[model samples]
Target chain A: MNDMHLCVVNITFLGKGPYTFSVGKGECVGLTGKSGIGKTQLFRAITDLIPAEGEILLDGRASASFSPTQWRSKVTMVPADSSWWYDRAGDHFPVKHKTSLLRESCMLLGLEPEVLDWQVSRLSTGERQRLALLRALQNNPTVLLLDEPSSGLDAYHTGLMEKYIGNYLRQNNPAVVWVSHDPEQLKRVASREFRMEQHRLYQIK
Target chain B: MDVIALTGVDLGLAASLLLLLSVLSVMLSLGLERKIIFFGCRMTAQLLLIGLVLRFLFASGSLLLVLLMSTIMLLAAGREVQARQKRKIIGLSGYLISVCAMFVSSFSVTVLALVVIIQVKPWYTPQYAIPLLGMLLGNTMTGIALALDRMTDQLHGRRGEVEQRLLLGQSWQEASSDIRRDCMRTGMMPIINSMAAAGLVSLPGMMTGQILGGTPPVEAVKYQILIMFLIAAGTGFGVVSAIWMSGLHLFDARHRLRLEILKSDKV
Candidate 1:
């Protein structure tokens, strides 16, 4: 991909916090850090979920000007522990193609189709995490913010997640800001990486 | 019919109704699955205690007693708003402003319209003044609380999206427009629903009481209309004032959300 296809963006938090680097158009950019180093803050800042000091541009258009609903619809964040407001996964998926996406995502995440009808309260941590990813993708967001997407998954499910994410990135070309603490997972999917430390982001080659 | 002789029975029935209402409130709370039994119990006890105090004051029929009771009501309303707010409101200014606004507007309107316009003698009569003031104050208090709660929640919850809008070159007013609208709507929903349901779903208290007191149905309807209008006006003013005052509380001199204000342990 050309450099112009994926523009560089600077995301700063609070008025004086350190700036974080973001890159991608349809690429997967892995963001790794120890807990509480502002990784989630960075995601929120980039998606315009929180107040920040820096500039984020998509295709050379500054993201600062877009309305929140527009920005969120375009660039979505899927939190690690997704809280459900509905009882069943089916209830949460409102779109027509939702079932198809759930089926495809379930196949990718090693989840069964029957899981969709299960009560959200009954779903295990791994299942919910997988379901959250599927839900986030349902909006066809231009940029995906994944906050520890595999935190609750077993090794088998984690492997499925890695494959699914890799293939999805290749097909969709939607940029990703994937946050993870797992080194092996990072190496498996991330084409570019940035490690957060001391509130500053350092690009990892 | 010698109805005046049944004053003792009337008092007893009113007391029993109050007790029944308290029980109904408890059952409603349970049905709603709220874990607020303690809060509900405290509110019931406080209201009953206030009722006893007011009964004594009414019997005395002193202007000084009426004024003291009104002051107490205002203070209690203020404290209730503050407690319900979870102390997310900054400083004492918002609570004070809300109390003052609700008190002055509602009290003046009730006194002037009910007493002066209608020419009810003994204008300081607790039976007339206290109940009217109580209705206005109670509704206003709830309106202010709802407005403040909704405004604060929207501002905090959508902070990120708001900042992004600002970055995208929207003015602060434009960026926070959604929050403002949503907060106002949320705060006003109850009043709107009540207005819609009035005279249909149930007979409102003022109208029912007026009818029981032997007022003609047509005359009772007029009073109900006036009371409902006054409530809507009181609620509107209370909500607007609370939201405007809360806007002042939300941002600091630096224009950042004073997040520390939201961290009260009182709730």
Candidate 2:
């Protein structure tokens, strides 16, 4: 359909089962699976982080058409445990995104504008996770690949994160592939749901 | 001034000094006693064999013989570089890259000095060519080894950071820019320090040997200066080429970090 923003057809990686799926604009497709059932690998393969064998399309264009960096810019992933190379938390961001948009994203995600000034080592896991979301958002990605974006957050911060992501989806109309272990969170955020089992993706009603 | 030739008796006196040191190491319960004696014997044997070979090389005076000797030296240096790395790239590419880097840097610099700078007669004269190549190879080998060792270790230790950058839409070069710069600095550090410390902190081995051989002190110092500059340039080029090649090898065609290709050494 013309509304399709991200599409995966028979993708397979690490000798796992071939996975086939697609997500439309403004749709959050939540994936739930047991630990080590290839959920993260699936996300990696979709984003071309790892080698995979299958066709992945973004906005009716094959991923192979763009360079890896170009493709990833449009389909960014917020990993569960983010890493920081620079000392200051703000230095990790691209300069163009360090403007007011970053400040606004931080406030919406229940983070302070001053958090950017803090040393990366001093930031708590929750703060790092939230900043990682902001980092992904700054790319203006057309499709988001989220792996446990709120795993480090408490209930209150989780609500704020969910609201921030929801607002982002409504405004940008990006297709999101969210992998979460919490069924309740999936039910609240995802309109179409799927569960990963033995590397295969199954759509759930 | 006539140079004093070292005789067997003189060398025997030096051997007694080593024996005394080894005995002292044993008496002090130092673990280096056996290593000292073993390495001393190994050094003697290796030097004697090379002396005989060099004599024959110089007598034969053929360009083919000189090239053969140079190739052998390059191979030995390549093996030394490979052995020094704790984590090495899998397959022959690792060996090839090291050898190629040394060959490009050391050989070219040695030839340039012989032909243009020093203007030595016959250019490939073993007396001048072999020693110069040997020094360049030795220094360049160490620089390459240090660079590659630091590179693999840093890449493995910072895997999470590298992948995060990749997911954030960075090219392989952009993701690895800091690591490349760090490795280059590590490789170049020793030569830079040695150059800084030369003449003041310690007498360089070549200048000391030349002076001991009864060459004018000022002449020996001039030669030492040339050799030092040559070694620095060789090491610089070798390290840069090796690091650049290794950097390219770190990522796959699609710009993914294929850390799997590096085989970790068993400590």
**Which candidate number has the best TM-score?**
2
True contacts kept of each: 0.03, 0.88
TM-score of chain A of 2: 0.96
Name the candidate that leads on lDDT: 2
TM-scores vs. true structure, each candidate:
0.62, 0.95
Across A1-205, the per-residue lDDT of candidate 2 in tens digits comes to 6568898989888888688888999999899888988888888888898999989998889999999999898998898889999999999986564468788778888899889989999999999999998888777899999999999999999999899889989999999989988899989899989888876888994
Lowest-scoring 10 consecutive residues by lDDT in candidate 2 chain A?
A94-103
True contacts kept of 1: 0.03
**What are the per-residue Cα lDDT tens digits for candidate 1 across A13-89?**
66434664556666787888788777776776666655676667766777656665566667777877675545787
Alpha carbon lDDT at A115, candidate 1: 87
DockQ of each: 0.05, 0.84
Show model 2 residue runs off by greater than 4 Å: A1-3, B7-13, B16-34
